[model samples]
Target chain A: MIGAIATAIIQATLVSAVYALIAIGFTMIFGVAGVLNLAHGALLMAGAYVYGIVVMRNIVPSMTYHPAVGVIAGIVVVAILSLLLYELLVRWVEDNVVITFLSTVILAVASTEFLVWIFGGQNIRISLIEGQFALANARVAYYEAIGFAVSWIAIALLWFYVTQTDDGRSILATSMSERGAQLTGVNIRMVRAKTWIIAGALAGLGGMFLGFDSGLSPLMWLNPLAVAFIAVVVGGIGSIKGSVAGAYLIGFIEQITVELIGNGFRGMPTLILLVGFLLFMPQGLFGREFAHE
Target chain B: MPVLQLEDVDVSYGKTQALRNVSLEVEEGEIVGVIGPNGAGKTTMLDSIAGYKEYSGSITYDGTEVSETSSGKLVNDGLVYCTEDRDLFPYFTVHENLQMGAQFRSDDGAVQESFDFVYDLFPRLDERRDQEAQTMSGGEQQMLALGRALMSDPDVLMLDEPTLGLAPVIIDDISEALERLQDEGLTILLVEQNSTFALRHAERLYLLEQGSIELSGTADELRDDDYIRDAYVGVT
Candidate 1:
């Protein structure tokens, strides 16, 4: 029992790293831009499919390339896509909460249709690093460990940029107070644009890992979107740190439930955790002062 | 030309008109004061000038029309507003708050000098440089707000109620700082509830009531007015 618990904890930590990436992007996008971004999962799907198409060379026939090149292409394309979504769509309707919310859901549905048209509804496998290792007496994939490392590195770089650089700090300050940001000459529009770009890169990296862990499907975005939404809410709606903490908490809950109970109950516990947070601690751990003027 | 000018400026909130055809001007190197009753539109006037609220009619600053300019660009171009809300980033330390005031400036030496200038003006901020803004006392937050505005190195500093609620001692410190700022030829547009403070600091004063100017004159000219004494100054 003890060994099983330890193994579960170890696995949970790896799973939480990717969740952190997805939720952090989701929360920051909400905090800064005031957009719920229901299409965040679609961005994730784009990353996986884009990475697969480039790395596998099945679609383009003559485009076989290094996996690293594929990763870069996936991230860049998603970043550009995120920027365009902001400039072309979200910017125009963000002020109307109902319109923006419905529009994002529409975008997500549209992306699914697009993906199904191209890749079909079948789950397609992508080749990844081929190795396994032992952790807490349980066999763990090398891919999971690498994904974990990349997630943390990206998070660390994001943290340093936010705290140590003026341009990056503007995003945080704007999320804190929009009027204050304007008073201090921080360009709110530019800060919001950069936030969407960051969200895209993070979602791409995290979504690519999710596809590698399972298999790529047109609808792979649904579960991860639900996970990101629950994590964001449980961690507090507009906080970046809270989302990270919430992600880990949800990840651990799901992992431990699956470990102790069964595979059929993987996500059942997080639903309960989400409801409990919403009821008792709606602000979560880091939701204090998350509002802006 | 006046450094700042507003002509026939009008503002409305849905159905109610807040300011009706208001006109004002402040020449360079002048401390202009706007004082009014609780419901009077003093802050609204400042808000309109700061681009926080939209208004009709012409507002010119340094030979350019500013009605179309954003609040951020207005601050970047030297029309800085220290809002009544003291909109400091609550989680940021005192030093970080001050750095934000000067973040856009290109001169390192000037920025460093601003840091020194702020610390010298509010030594409380110097002592608590690492303290977060939200944790500080209201008076200290007010001082930090003023200090942050000063960091912008404003050509025209529009301050709204710098001494709203404070101990007399802190107000004295702010008074001394404002006097020194005036001595160094800084233009200030001060909105204050404290009539005495406004009278002492402002060279020219406007008494606003019911969304329009009731009286306007130099400080000496308005000092003996019976209405000014009865309504605002509370002096015999």
Candidate 2:
């Protein structure tokens, strides 16, 4: 029983790290650009597929193929795709939230379909680390442990960038008031583009971890997308710290449920928690009261 | 030649016209004031000049037509406008707000100099530089708004009602700051509902009424004019 509990705890920590990585991008996009980028999931899928191709197909034959290279390539490809998405779709329809939402959702579907065509809809797994370790009667995979460490490091780096960098502060200023930022000579378009790129890179990095842990399928994007969205909503729409907290909250709850009540009932508790938060505290735990349009 | 010139400018909000054929000029090293009652297109004029409002007119700054320029580019060219609403990033501390004002400038030395200049101008802001702008009183916020505008190192500073809700002492402080800024050769275009303050500070004044300039003269000339005294100066 103690071993089972320990395993559940380890699983919860690893899952939370992945969720936080995915959700942090979602929250930042919402906070800075005020758009719910449903295509975020598509970016993750793109990253996973890119990583899969790099590792499995050996895209660069002359160079030694490493898992780290796959991860980096995934991040770079996703970042570029994200910038393209912003320029082609998000920027044009930014003023209209409904249209932006619809366009991104459609894009998500199109990207997933494209992935299905390329990968033949099969679960493709790439083993970055080929071993597991035992701790307190609980076993943890080396890749899973590496993923958790990378997630925390990424989160810390992001936090430092946003809070300590001049460019990042300009983003925060733009988020608060577009006109105010413009008055300060900040180019809003450039800031938004950079934000999309950063968010995409993060989603891409998270995608590599997700792909390593559970393999990749065309439909794999939906699960992470749903969980990340839940994390963003529960933490508060615009708060980065809240996104991390919400990720852990949902992660632990899901793990505990799966351990105690069986895997079939794992999602039920999170759904209940989401509904309770929406009903009682729509602004979320860390979200400020946004101005009404 | 004027440092800034607006000729035959007409601005409209959908169907409602806010400024009709408004023409004005501010020469280099001059403090030009636009004084009028509420709803007389004072703010609209500033908006049009700042490129925030779409207007059909020729607004020339530094001898270049500026109707098509974006506000951010305009700021980079040293045309800064401080809106009436104070439009501050409320969550940012006073110092951060000032830093934001200089965000686009690549010259660190110049940015630091601008910070020192603003801090020297409004010592109160320096005292509470770490405090969030929203927590400050109305007067301090106004000071911050003005200081923030100055941080851009503007060649022409357009102020929209700088003393709208401040105490008398605070108003005097603002007036003194404007005088010092003018003395330092910062060309100003001030719009004010407070005619007395405008009349006292402006070297040249334009009396705006019903979206047009009714009278334009030096401050003393307007002060002594019978129509200006009765209508704007409250001297029956």
User: For each candidate, what is the lDDT?
Assistant: 0.89, 0.88
Counted clashes in each candidate structure: 0, 0
> What fnat does each of the candidate structures reach?
0.63, 0.87
What TM-score would candidate 1 get against the native? Answer: 0.96
Clashing pairs in 1: none
Candidate 1: what lDDT? 0.89
Q: How far is candidate 2 from the true structure (C-alpha RMSD, Å)?
A: 2.2
DockQ of candidate model 2? 0.81
Question: Scoring each candidate complex against the real one, what DockQ results?
Answer: 0.75, 0.81
Tens digits of per-residue lDDT for model 1 on B1-236?
Answer: 99999888888899988888888899999999999877789889998898878989888888777877778888988999998899998988999888889878979899999999989988999999999999999889999999999999999999999988888898998899999899889999999888899999999999888778889999998888988988888943
lDDT of 1 by residue, A1-293 (tens): 77777789888999999999999989999988788999999998899888899888565678778889888988999998999999999999999999999999999999989888987889988756788998778778988998899999999999998887888888988888888888999998999999999999999999898888987898899888989999998888878788888899988988988877998999888888888888898877787645754
TM-score of chain B of 2: 0.97
